[model samples]
Target: MTAPQDHAPSDVPPAPRGGAGPVHSDTTQSAIRQSTSGMPTRPHGDDVHAAAGSATQPTGQADWSAFGPGGSGTAPPNTDEADRPAFEPDRGGTASADHALAEPQRVRRLKIALMVCGAAVTVGMGVAIAVLMEEASPPLRVGVASRPTGSHAPAAPPAIGGSSGASGAVPGNAGAGAAPANAIACPLPGGPAACPAMVAIPAGRYRMGSRRTDPDAQEEELGGAERAIAPFELSAHEITAGQWQLCVNQGACPPPAQPPQSSTMPVTGISWDAAAAYAAWLSQQTGQPYRLPTEAEWEYAARAGASTVFPWGNQLGQRHAHCGQCGTLPDYAGLAPVGSYPAQRGLYDMVGNAYEWVADCWTPSHAQPVPPAQSACHEKVQKGGAYDTLEADVRPVARTHGDRATPDVRVGFRIARQLQRTEQ
Candidate 1:
């Protein structure tokens, strides 16, 4: 082995020395110094080095000169040993410090997630409250005018209480140019030849509705209330087909569904709005407050101071009015001439002929009182029975209702004028 060179094998131990000697190779000494550079100086450093050298040595010959304190391969002892702690692996301590430093970041991340979740929940509730406010509004109304053309024909005799004069003028004509001192001549476009007669109703108070104990009283007619009425004038008979035709001719009102079967029959198939429009047209033509009668006034006038169901009596007589089975019509008991029935208080067909529209809103029962002043309403009140009505419905107190825009052949209306104080 050529004298085994000068270096010993790295895994071998030196032979027993007479005094202290190096026990490790240069490479092993360098590794130990790098690993324990930050370790504290110990009183037994040489002994510890010897023990490390012995533990790493293989079971063979090796040089130990390089590991000695003054050997050329040895590094200088660390001078910052006192300022640094010993090289002890602080696994638990270092891990705890790292965890402490990282804890706030984890908590911050957790808080950010919570805030994001909370914000998401709050935005979901604000969208639900805006949808409920748009569904509570009322409806609107539209009006259209329609009329048909024809020649002015002779009107049949007015219904009961109507004047029989050939001039076609109402009795006591006293408007614009007339004779009666207490009445104003109705402003008819055709002069006295185009209008029906009107009756002067005196101002007074009367029981307006039916008594609750009355035999055939409906809940809506059971209040038996008394109303003080102002003096007003009413058409003697329901508006005849000839009279309505004059309105149509003047282009002030719409034409009926069919031309008058006879000029004497009451005009039918009219709606409350159409009737109101007619009254407005008449007001313009006559320069008077022509309108529909109030419910209370209509009932009071129809009763004619009689406490019985019909104007004549409690018993329904065939000749008393034109209802379903109680009319004088021969074959079919359909609509009859306006004056076919008897008159009460100079007014004709107060109980039967056509269901008349009044100037009051509909109420289910008389128990609930309506305000006296007029206002907009969806449904309107109708009074009196129609030619097609049953006997029980012909009572002066019988009541009915319909929508403001509805039209029926059995329905019609008459005009009312507020009496001037002088006229009254």
Candidate 2:
């Protein structure tokens, strides 16, 4: 999607408004609900194993009643060896006249007995084979179509793509029974004011900083190491002026130095402190914890499953972002409206819009311990280069910092909310 140039500021639609509940985008609510609703509950591995075991065992004994006399379900008592009749042949290999009558009767009885015994053996073998076939079969899965013989195991849940260095889990999955942030539409708290659309970011681990070997790597971003992040929800787009205005209307946030011409434009000229205040105000209204994303989180989301220098690729492609000298924009001097560009990992304007405030202090280098947020703060971290940023500066690893209380036209912030879990 490209920025709207023909439409006037008034022609641009206001941001979506939600009713009193968990907030999400209006477009995605039905889809998310449908997806989650239709999604079959995954069977536990242990449960599947248990089912397989039960299927293999013999269900019951085979009926052999037909072989029993009078259908009594029991075989007749065995005859003693001495009582069994034996045939005798004369010198010519033929039965003599005196034993001819007895021989015929004995032979008939012997053949009948043998036939009954053979039938019993055959029935027993059939039962054994049936049990074996059941044991070899795999447990059936619900909502998944059965594969042809010799096919691979049932397919896994579709992978929801996310940041690099970690496999994607279900997209926008918060927990059991919880919908993804973008999919669930709810009302904004306190009034009918519009709320920022949120995207659910799955939990994953990745390298947090740049390596020393890289030419564009910053000293502050070196000595990077793998870091684990928890599941959380972030605004799909940079917080728009219309959303901030709602907070200001409630007297919960400070006014911007210069109001945006269009409500859809990302709100700038707001201090880090003001951003934090807006987060707190949102938490109070929605009864959900809201705050700024951590520095590591910002990088991970910006990368959006890409390991390249830029989320799109190693090079800064045209119209991918709004940055100075980045090219492909009608106006590089000013910020475009929110969602003016494509999304990464379902997040929009992560790299080139306004430099976003993160919830971390500006340490000199990666070697030093990160200062705690509770402690006295000096300069806070900002990420995702701004409109005036060069191509090299508009990377996931790029960072800038300023006094927490000071506001700049090049800076703005997004909101992140915690994912709550419920008992299954």
lDDT of each: 0.50, 0.54
Q: Tell me the TM-score of each prediction against the true structure.
A: 0.56, 0.57
lDDT of 1 by residue, 1-424 (tens): 0000000110111100100000012222112111111111100001111121111212442243443344332333334435435664456456445645565565557557866766665554334322221111100000111121223222444433332211221222111111112445766766653555667766566665656676655566665555566667787778877778878888877777545566667887667787888888878877877899888778766766555566666676655665433422221234456765556656777765566788988776676777565456757776675443344456666666666665645567887878765554
On a 0 to 100 scale, what is the lDDT of residue 44 in model 2?
Answer: 10
lDDT of 2 at 114: 65
Stretches off by above 4 angstroms in model 1 are: 1-183, 371-375
What lDDT score is found at residue 322 in candidate 2?
57
Candidate 2, after superposition: displacement of residue 251 in Å? 0.7
Cα RMSD to native, each candidate?
45.9, 23.1
